[model samples]
Target: MGEEQFKGVFVEEALEHLTLLENALMELEETPDNMELVDSAFRSMHTLKGSGAMFGFDVLSHFTHDIETVYDLVRSGSMKITQELIDLTFCAKDEILCMLRNDYDTIPEVQKKKDELTKEFKDLIERYRDGGNGATAKGTLKKPDGKSIPDEIIVKDIEAPRYTYRIRYRPCTSCFLRGTNPLLNIEELAGFGRASIVAHMDDIKFLDEYDPDACYAYWDIIVTTEKEIDAIKDVFAFEDESSEVKIEVIDVSGELDGGDQYKKLGEILLEKGDLTQDDLDSVLGLHKKLGELLVEKGVVNADIIEAALAEQVHIREEKKSQQTSVEETATIRVPADRLDTLVNLVGELVTVQAHLTQMAVKRIDYELLNVAEEVERLTCELRDNTMNIRMLPIGTTFDKFKRLVRDLSKELKKEIILATEGAQTELDKTVIEKLNDPLVHIIRNSIDHGVETPEQRKKVGKPPKGTITLSAIHSGSHVLIRVKDDGKGLDVEAIKNKAIERGLISANAELSDSEIFSFIFAPGFSTAKEVTSVSGRGVGMDVVKRGIESLRGSIGIESARGVGTTITVKLPLTLAIIDGLLVRAGAGSYVLPLTSVLECIAISKDEIDQNHGRELTMVRGQIIPYISLREHFFINSTEPVNQQIIICEVNARRVGVLVDQVIGEHQTVIKNLGGIYKNVETLSGATILGDGSVALILDVNRLVNLVEGVERDAVKRLGMASEMSVCE
Candidate 1:
């Protein structure tokens, strides 16, 4: 066929092979002794090399060959899989990706790196090759009986049913330059069975315009006789190393004479009864003189003509499928940019629908109002659909941690097991991508700092093997991701002393347990006695805090020394939009994430009390600290007759935010407040109200901290709070 068609096939198959390679490597790591995984890995590489050579990627094929050879040995049980071998395979996989992207200038350096890794692979293979005898040598397989064995094993003399060999050969563009003859390969196949060629002229250029150095023709040969597929494959063994070839068995026993030859476009159309001789003649006439024929003859309706054309197209596709080796399957590979574009379009549609709703409310036209209402309903559904497209199960990220924990535990000389729960919880793709690195850092820190050694754990009357648990769940409009470790928890006193020494807190400063523990996320803060490369470098925890914050999320730590530590991160379900509780704060309107707002109550003057010069309100049976927007934002107000208190929860702690009035629920479109307002503590983002006014989205976590900090300071001064006031 056309070069474009072949190129598409090559790219598709190459990507499939790459994915297979990655999956096989992952499986091989877990079950290194499973020969099936090794064999599958080898086949994927072999197919990739053959496909790459067909597509003019010579360097890729050459580099992959070496890796394939190593896997081949492993598949034959002559070599054993080891950690070093797996690492080398990962490097090889990376190189194959680079080669697929057509990067060749650095191939030499990459090959050098591969050579070094291959040397280690060779050493391991030799070690295993010497069997359990503990001798190291090359090019020999020694059994446990201490006897040298042959390099390769052969199985022969098996009988099976008679089969026909159908070989298809599509040479590479540079085949002629390599002094290869496709005709000679076809002739060599005669040794296996009776062979006849069906020359394909679909890819041939014009005789006068053809490039002499490029092979442009393909051949489909049918050999009807009793012979194994491998026997036929061996005939063209030399050419098969560099050519694109497919061999399959055809059962001619149930077909009519000349069936294969009749599988052409026009013949298939006739056989399928989609077109008659007269219809074909009429269409051909119209195609040749299109402008006149349409008006001159009333042969058929335009719809009928279109339908006939569609049928002809389908027929051609069916014929092409039968003639080619490619399988017929329904699948689509879309570029990532297209999905992003679709999401953006859906977002814009939602915004426009909001504007339309505004206009429809002002007009008195019933029909226009009805249309806008329907549009709003559709827009909501569309938004949800688009969001769902970007949602992926969190299990994909969790499965990778097993390998991480396995490798790290071995390195640390500790026994640790990672248990994941609710891994099927779904989150936006963007959130998952950003969460990977932070989660890895947290997991590493748990292994290095949180989990104690086996000896220490045994002394503490705990299990020798520490367990780190990762769980995710949906909470209202957010997803809660928790990393819990069964190890030594945070030491509040040590953290307090470090904060004082680092000038983070005053020496005489008094703080609660949670407040003291928060110091771990502060910049340049660490409590480790000695720094290891895995952790205690004082770099990642703060970064994790910043990353969670960047996603409009909050993180908190809960700990009990010698019990355990749990770090929970709360993130918005989707970043593009949110449901908010809009309220009037000072002269401006602010939106509080509806997910965090529990209830609102109007408080009379009698309920307002000044305790140690701090505003406090009794909600239900609990005394909750309150922060007034007027005082917090420097908004001067003369009277406070009937004040409203908005009770909100932050990480399971309740607090009240005093506002002028509660304005009802709003469907908010989150807009970034630029770099200047990024550091604003109490505001997460901004949105436009139905009245066309800009409203600030309140950060519940930050507000909780502010109000709680104020109340704690007041209680510390008065010395009247409970001993459990240390909120851990």
Candidate 2:
């Protein structure tokens, strides 16, 4: 692979390892005795370190090695996990993220922190690996049977660690000035196991042509190391600044100890990269030890032949391991922009199909109308299929919050458990991405403010270990996501007092429990007396509400003094298109989301006029507030004698929306109004109608808010008039 392509793959693979490593660590903290988690963590660290080294990220590799060493002890039952160790691991995880992002400015600070934490790991390894002096720690690193651990164990569970590499190192003419010693690197590689070298004198110039300062010497070094190719390459980290170093793994587990080997001469020659495959294939017909024959013909030097034979055995061993690895499931990673484009194209197709249907209906041709209906059917099917492709299970997004809960519980010194249900609930990928932050904020609030401390819970006769449940499930065409907490619920009177004190509501304001609970979403409204890093600063719920609402969703809260609090967010299945009820206020048609609509109630203009002050009327003995679309949009035309009120629920309260006429259901292809209608909160967006007219899509949540705003004003006016009458 090309360098850039390989780097992309490395980053993708490295991030996966990091995620698995973090999760395993979290699980390990809960069950420190679980060997499976220990092994998982060990494997992740091993892979990460090797990959980092392979990509020339020596800093990453070296730091991870210390962590790997500690986990090795943990896996072997030499070291027991402690709270101190888990804290250090969390710090290490953060440092690894900073390193992966390559934030140079932050890396220096993280590096210093890494050094401090890694030393603790090193000390633990030293104290447990032997029974000698400085044994202040309680854990033993030594094997219980008094058996010495092999050097191979320091790496991983491998049968053999003998990999031969033929190195060609030629330094820059002025490399000596860089203070990089090539011989030192060579010595380090030899320290692992075995080594041999043959200096290439062919490149050396004649004495008259050579310069004293510029070195002309280079070498072909043969070495076998008890490490991976990446580990050996790491030795040359500094050497690459001014040298050309080519190190290829010629063999992985060759039995080079025997003077007489079983490897054929042609195979060895081909592996050494000196001879091509065609040359070996030609000689394979002569099924004899070809090396002796080659020696007899004086084709290659004795030393060169010796190195190839040593490499030949290890190559075959490498092949055996390759054949044993299970095939990995392949996946393709596509850019998000491409998916967005596809969704947009499908949206256009929906619009065009609507236009075609309108054209066929206007023409009154049976065949054209039939074809149009068929086209519409196919279009709807296409839209559904395309949307399904974009739908992803919310479990992945939910899984991410485990770490958040873990670290926060630790920092706050509170015992908490996060349980999730309906994690497999699917939603549009776009909606899922937008939902993450809101979920995070809500979870943080649940952890910080909603959930009580262990001692506090016990005093209230509740379980000391608080529980926060995150759940998602489909409700018809929408999804209901609930973040429920088991702790001291919202103190209603306290919230009421806070709302009154904040001037959000009057003392005489009579509201339902849900309405009173929704006061928590007011901007900068919080009952929190103290501010911490978590959600107590009063800046969270408002943002969460706004985020969910921006996606055509609504959030509601239910709380009891001692029971608990559950914040439920209702969201559309997809943001692309929806089924809506089309209606007209004056000349303009508006579309109301079909999912929210209950039943329409027709009322005459006379009834609407008589009930002017309250903007409400009796619907089956229920006084439901209604929004007059004519007045809402400032329609200049007079209202028709017969009008309809669309009954819909928003924020847990059912309300009526007045319209001039009800024009049945519409298959809406929503389009952005962009800058033109961006400021109009009452109208969410515009959609193209069948007749090529633009229909404004009403924001039911905002429409309910408008009716509430009118009521607040009426109450203010009434209070003022009453005071004036008392003065009179």
Candidate 3:
């Protein structure tokens, strides 16, 4: 890979580490005594610092190192996790993201933020050094067992008592694929103090049989350092489970008997576990060296003997020293564009499968039909698998709102808690990405307009800390995301007055509370008496409506007088493909989503004439309102003698769509109609048919809404006419 590609990988990995850090910090705030959370945060920062420096992100590495130190203190129990430190770390995490995006240390504004955060972190470190603010004394460090040890033992370069450690490291065969370089780890181990390393090359294959991507050689490293055993363990902290590592303190502070002799070669080999005691004793009687004797007797491999010999010599030289040590999970990240391409290819395959099916049905060959059926089945499975790859749990987006709710509630001086449920409900990446903005607006509106202040809430017999529940539940092929708040519900009287004042609805117009509440989504409509930073400009709900509708989703609001308000957004599982009912109205073909289709019933022009201008029909003693696609789209054609009313459920209401024919089911691959039809709200997108014809996908909810809007205008005009006549 090129330098740029390597840096890109680093950026991606660093951002992920930052996310982990952010989540851990957020949780730490709730449970300050949770050492696991502190450890988790520390690990992420440590990785970021190490990887950032390796990837040439010097400024990011430096800034991270300081923060990592504070976390290290917490990990050591030398400092307690405080709200101030958590907030500082959160700010640092944000700044690190900025640094990563701006090439680390570039961009004057980001640099300034870095400087400020660096100062704060340094202050925390100083506080720890001075044993102030819940920090331990400067001269002591906490051990794993909570015992205070002198600080000199923890410092690597200090001239204090040290230990000599022998480390055995064997990398996994697939270690290279995971981007780990064992040599780098060995080099890091050498940095602690005087060191000697010997590679055991016995596992290497012949040149012709060699695999470049596989690590065949293992190592035995001997290090004499002032650092403690934990410091040595950290050198291999990131190694995966497939690799093997064992670290033991061979000699402490180079202490030896008056003879200045280390453990005998045979005993060292035995202690190193390279040979059993039987093998050591059998070789001990030989006149030649024990290592040479063992190799000749085939009792131990030449490489193992060589490593043991190396360890023996090194430890004898200084009377030397010591050294170290740690994926539970593995993942390969592919760029999103690649997954998008795969989804598009799968969609194309679905379309081709439909064409083959159509051709087989038209032909009389049974063999061809069977082949087409098999292909159809395979295509369906392939389509589902490809879509599944793009499916992400909605919890990722939910987690982001935690920080948002925290900041916004703090700014608004309202004590509110965000509660989420069904966060694991899965949705297409496309749908999830588009759903974010709308959900943000809804939650913001709820916090600003829906929820009352703590004082007001208490007076109303509600808890001071209000709760806004964000939840998702899968309903067949659709996902319903509801943002509900236990606050003062939307005021119908206020909405009614606003609608009339804005000329949105006529005074004294008979409307349901649902209809009245919907006026909040009108452009520039607000019930707030004044505007604030959080909301009240009225753009939030309007944006929410447009964003949801653009995703071919429907949103509805339900509220009680003093209880609460719930905004429900219903979205399709995926936008790439859908099961739709193909229908024809005049020359135009349309596809109604199969999930929305209830049933189709035959209706005639005679029945329509009985209802006259009402366009309402009696279906099993129930009044069913309908929209004629032919009249709505202005398709010029003679009315069919036999018509069908396709019953569809839209926004929890069943409505019928009049069409000339119901043409079975179609697997629809939706294609955008481009900018020309962008503003056309009634139609979502268009799809290609097996016969190579274009069929428009109907937005059932929007269609019903458009029809209701037209009917409402008619009623308003009629009411005015009746009033004028009475006056006359």
Candidate 4:
């Protein structure tokens, strides 16, 4: 294989191992005494090192060796896990990531970081080993069970009893071409204990028939080890179908005469598949040792019989580990664009079927109508199935925040705990991808601006560690995500003052609590007294709001002066399709995201005139503001005498939108608007109706804000009009 092909595969596997290492380190922090965690961490580093070396990342291999040694010490209980050690591990993890990203141009910087980390690790180990003693001493370290580790060596083969095993290893002629190095496997097996190798050359062809690239040699071996049978198999983890390895327990549990107990020459040859059982029996009868007779008969070579005191297929049938044995559901990785094309085709199918069903409804032929109805049902199911394939669990995104929270908390010298719930909630993969950045900003804002210092928290009788919770739940057709922080919350008066000072709000203007909090999202607006690296420069929350809205979602903020704050974001389950609340206003039919529409009510002409053109109306004793779509869109068509009120949640408030008629719910496939209509407000996108008409999707959030701006303008005009009347 080409270097590039193996490079990508090696990188992918290395990343997977690194993730495992990080997870193990995190768990070790919580349970410092868990030896399994230490072993897991060590194994991850070991695999990464081996794979890195095989893939020609020698720098990576060498650098990781030092880090791996630290974990080896940890696994042997010669070192301990401290905050400093875990911190260094995380730094090392980041460095390994950099290496994988091939920051080779910065090799000096990378080497410098590697040296610094290794020194820190050795220093930390020395600190624990010396126990602050001024004088150095060398002695065996005893375990908690009072067993002393031999002073002559470190951990390997320490406690477990050694058992000698005879082995045979044979490899495919083309194994090296596929990147399999049997020597590497043999070298690793040697790490277990003392190993003796005998090269068997019977498989070698004559000079004229020989191929340089073809492997013609096999091996018979003997090894004494304390490791498990599985550990021996692990040495050949990269073995493929063409390779053959057989291991037998000739001497286990202290069988002293292990050499004499090994399989005889004919039996060894039979075991390697070089001879049949009947051939072995016949050969055994001919000579005491088969070597001379086999060579005379030209049946085999001297080397083949010389290594008779072999050894994997015996252990091949050994039950695999639970982790490996479980049946793996087969899957194939296809390009994402192919799945998207499949969805698009399914979407077109739905559109066509909708047209067919509509035509069938108007026909009197029952048979044709039934077929159309069935086709519509199948199309809907297909659309749902196709869309479901794009859904992914949000937990993968949530898991990434642990590192973020850890790093930020350490950098700021604050103790913060990230609490997450409902991470199993799934959303369209595209929506989840876009949600990541906005969520990061929100969490950063929570940490930088919202959460109080540990000292501050304790003074207020709260826990020393502040907590930021991220939660998601399926609510109807939307996912309700909340980022809540238990910290000293927003000061309304301070926000109002800052808003007025920045010209975001007028002095002496009366505003609700929600309105005061909304000022934080105004561009270039901040209540922060000074800028910090994290978030104080006013570049965060406003962009967060805009990003959420871009996904056809909405953000709402709730805060208490001294208690805490919660920012709730409502996102559509999918961006590709929506259950739309279709409505008609003037000449155009519009699609409102069903998740945004709460209810539809009637408005009477008498009530409209009673209000005398005021845009506020009473609904069940509550005075809610309303917006007129005809005026907003600048439609020349006359308004309907009796209009319907679509009550929608805007900025977490009940706002009514007036439309000519309610066309009911629809399964609308969203299509983006062209560049020409990009700047238009109160219109998000468009969708195709059953009759092939284009219905614009309303931007409910923006529509409500527009009406509020108009209301403020009208109030100012009326006041000036009243003053002029009095002056006259």
Q: In order, how many clashes per candidate? A: 0, 6, 7, 5
- Our model 1 lands, by Cα RMSD against the true structure, at 17.5
Compared with the true structure, what per-residue lDDT tens digits does model 1 show for residues 128-235?
654533333443335678675542331121434445555667777678888888878877775555555656565668979889788887766666555667888776
TM-score of each: 0.63, 0.71, 0.73, 0.68
For candidate 4, the 10 contiguous residues with the lowest summed lDDT are 314-323
Best by TM-score: 3
Per residue, candidate 3 scores C-alpha lDDT tens digits across 515-621 of 88889888999888888998778788888888897787888899986799999999989999999999999888999999888999998788888776777877899
Which runs in model 2 stand beyond 4 Å of their true positions? 1-9, 105-107, 131-330, 717-728
Of 1 and 3, the candidate ranking higher by lDDT: 3
Q: Candidates sorted by TM-score, descending order?
A: 3, 2, 4, 1
Q: Model 2, residue 693: displacement in angstroms? A: 2.6
lDDT of 2: 0.80
Model 4 local distance difference test score? 0.79
Kindly list the per-residue Cα lDDT of model 4 for residues 1-728, writing each as its tens digit.
Answer: 69997898888888878888877877777898898888778777777887899999987887777677676666555677777778888998998888887666467888788788878866765655544212122223455676655523433324455566777889889987887778888788778776767887767899999998888887877777778788887777778878888886655544434232334567667766666776555556664457777777767777666666334221222212211544564456555789888877887787788777777777776888899988988888888888889998898788778788878987888899888899889899899999999999999989887888889988989988999999999998899999999988989998899977865556889999988999888787787788878977889898998899888888989998678999999998898878889899988999888887888889977888899888778889999888888878888887778899999998778999888999888888877799999988778889888889989999899877766767677776787799899999
* Candidate 1 wrongly placed segments (more than 4 Å): 1-30, 47-60, 90-112, 122-331, 362-368, 454-465, 499-516, 560-563, 604-613, 636-641, 705-728
lDDT winner among the candidates? 3
**Candidate 1 accuracy as lDDT:** 0.73
lDDT score for candidate 3 against the true structure? 0.85
Candidate 3 Cα errors over 4 Å, as ranges: 103-106, 132-330, 711-728
Tens digits of per-residue lDDT for model 2 on 504-620? 788888988887888998889999888898866789898998899988999989887788899999999998889999999999999999999999989997887786566888988
TM-score of 2: 0.71
